[model samples]
Target: MTETLRASAPPVATGAGAIAVLRDLASYVDARAEAFSARSSWLVAAATHLAGEPVVVVAHEDGQVVGLAALSVTRHRGTARVTLLGGELNDYGQLHHDGPRAARALAGALVDWLRAQRRWSLDLTQLAPEDPALAALVRLLPGAVVSPGAPMPRIEGVGTSYRVKRDRRRKATGAFNAAGRDGLRAEKLVLDDLAGLERWLPALVEVRRARDHASGRRSQLDDPGVLAFHTSVVRGAVAAGAGVVHVMLVEDEVAGFVTVLVDGDTHRLYDGRVAERWLAYRGGTVCDIEAVLRAQDDPGVHTFDWLRGWTEAKFGNAEVVRAGLHASSHPSVDRLDRWEATARRRLKAALPDAAVRRIVSR
Candidate 1:
């Protein structure tokens, strides 16, 4: 039986009710949904704290949210551009939808919405190559430019074996003995409530700052807006019982940490950082191994996603999946946007890291 579909009005802002529904739909539709990014909580949080205007399009069936797309309108190089909300931090780009039919309807609605917002060209990043949303977009927008994005590594059946656990202990003891550090411990904080998130978030941010400074790089979390968005999204996910924070300490100080989000059966490491000084002690390895143990114990989770990176040596043994990038615009502006993007990439590559950071912050 065919379902009746009706797209909501050009969305200026989504109400709480609709947003909640969209949040659930994301997990329902995407098997490997990065809860921190795919959920509507991310969209709402980004809209609240990040710059630029928010644009959301919704498709409903029987008065329930069946599909949706959340976007932001901003000026890029003096031209209005539309991009996926939370694109900078999000691991994947997907149209939140119920199924194949809803995907097609949502794609059609996106086309109409894009036409109405004629001044803005679309640029979506990190789309999974096999995503129905990507397929729908390509089918409808044949002229859209498509490119390959980074590969996302994932580990299935992530439970640690007896040998792995023994190796971990051996490494920890050896490192502790060599460093002469007696106060070494790891704590995996299962932040299922807002109060816990509030308590630990500041320390996590500071750890990230210290790590960046040690590595001679700047942390994006240093930006007040980005920090606020992350706070909101994590809090929202934790409150929904879908996320947690794992922190490892040395001498009772934060040494390394990672945020994990469980979307259905998949566990994802959203972000993590380790202090440079602690690298000698395998701080990051300890934290990640513990995450794998946690996932193994949880009957609800079966896979652990390492997210976007080709660090084979670091990950040991994990499978790789393809991610994608794409852009679409009116023929008049397509060439212009593409050219401007190429120029910006080239200039960014040529400039010093500090110079590029300054330009991006502005």
Candidate 2:
């Protein structure tokens, strides 16, 4: 039996209409067990609003929305390009589909639609290597390019007792003690602290800026759009009970802060920053350890995800490698995207820490 599938780009509206679509799509994705950050209606709406355009592509199977490919269109160097809706903010780009057959049909249809629109390219980076939709798209689009994505570090067993290396554990504990001796107190930001969140956000941006300047690098928060988007999303997430912020203060002055996103049993560290003046006290490390402890204590959290990158801090925990995908009707564009991705990996490998940070911050 042949399954009928059709794809269409729907105009996304705000308010009640948007919520209705999100509710329906979220329900469908949850039923298929293909839920992820990008697939969430909240995130989709936020991404669309931040992008200031509507580019949601829906795949309907027998008159029901079974899959979607949300994208944001932007002009780069005189050429329009389309990227996953949340862009770099999303750790993983999802193509929410009912199953393999539906995924294949959606992939083919999406490709045809994209070609007809004549976009320069479509980039979906930092996808899990084993993502079903990625495999389907690659299989259907012969010109698609595959590349390695930054490896995201994660700490599993959040709700259980997890073991850490003895030396690292000792160091983390020592940092916590040092902070305590310095009269630094840690607290989790709650819904009631919306005002505090507003205050601390700009402080975090400043701290990040100072740290990056000292290290001779740029900060992503330097971009007005990125900063605005983060501020809006974090505010919305907190209101929706989907996010939390942890803060460490010294004499009532903000010293460090960490923002995390909650999705069911998992918590992802979205961003973190520490005042440069507090580095000697290791405020950042202390804040991180406290955040981990809180996650372990919370009955709702079962895993702590450091998100898409490996660092020394994540060494004692488990890690996962994600991949990136690029596809275009033009073979040359596909090759170029692949080459650029490979070059980025190589550059990151060869550059000094400060130089690499500068490159990535942009």
Local distance difference test, candidate 1 = 0.67
Pairs with steric clashes in candidate 2: 152-309
Q: Which ten residues in a row have the lowest lDDT in candidate 2?
A: 1-10
Locate the minimum summed-lDDT window of 10 residues in model 1: 1-10
**What TM value does model 2 have?**
0.78
Per-residue lDDT over 1-362 for candidate 2, one digit per residue giving the tens place of the 0 to 100 score: 11222223243333344444555465454454422456565455455455534355666666656677666667654345777667777776676677777677667767766666664677887766776778888887767788987777777886575634467657866765676676766443432256757776777778777777667566666767667767777877776777778777665555677788777788878778777777766666766776777787887777888887776666436777778887666666656667989997897678887776656456
List TM-scores for all candidates, in order. 0.78, 0.78
lDDT of each: 0.67, 0.66
Misplaced by over 4 Å in model 2 are 1-26, 29-36, 39-42, 45-53, 159-170, 176-195, 331-362
Could you say which candidate leads in TM-score?
A: 2
lDDT of 1 by residue, 219-319 (tens): 77878988898777777778888888777666666667788887788888887887676777655666676676688777667778888877632353565
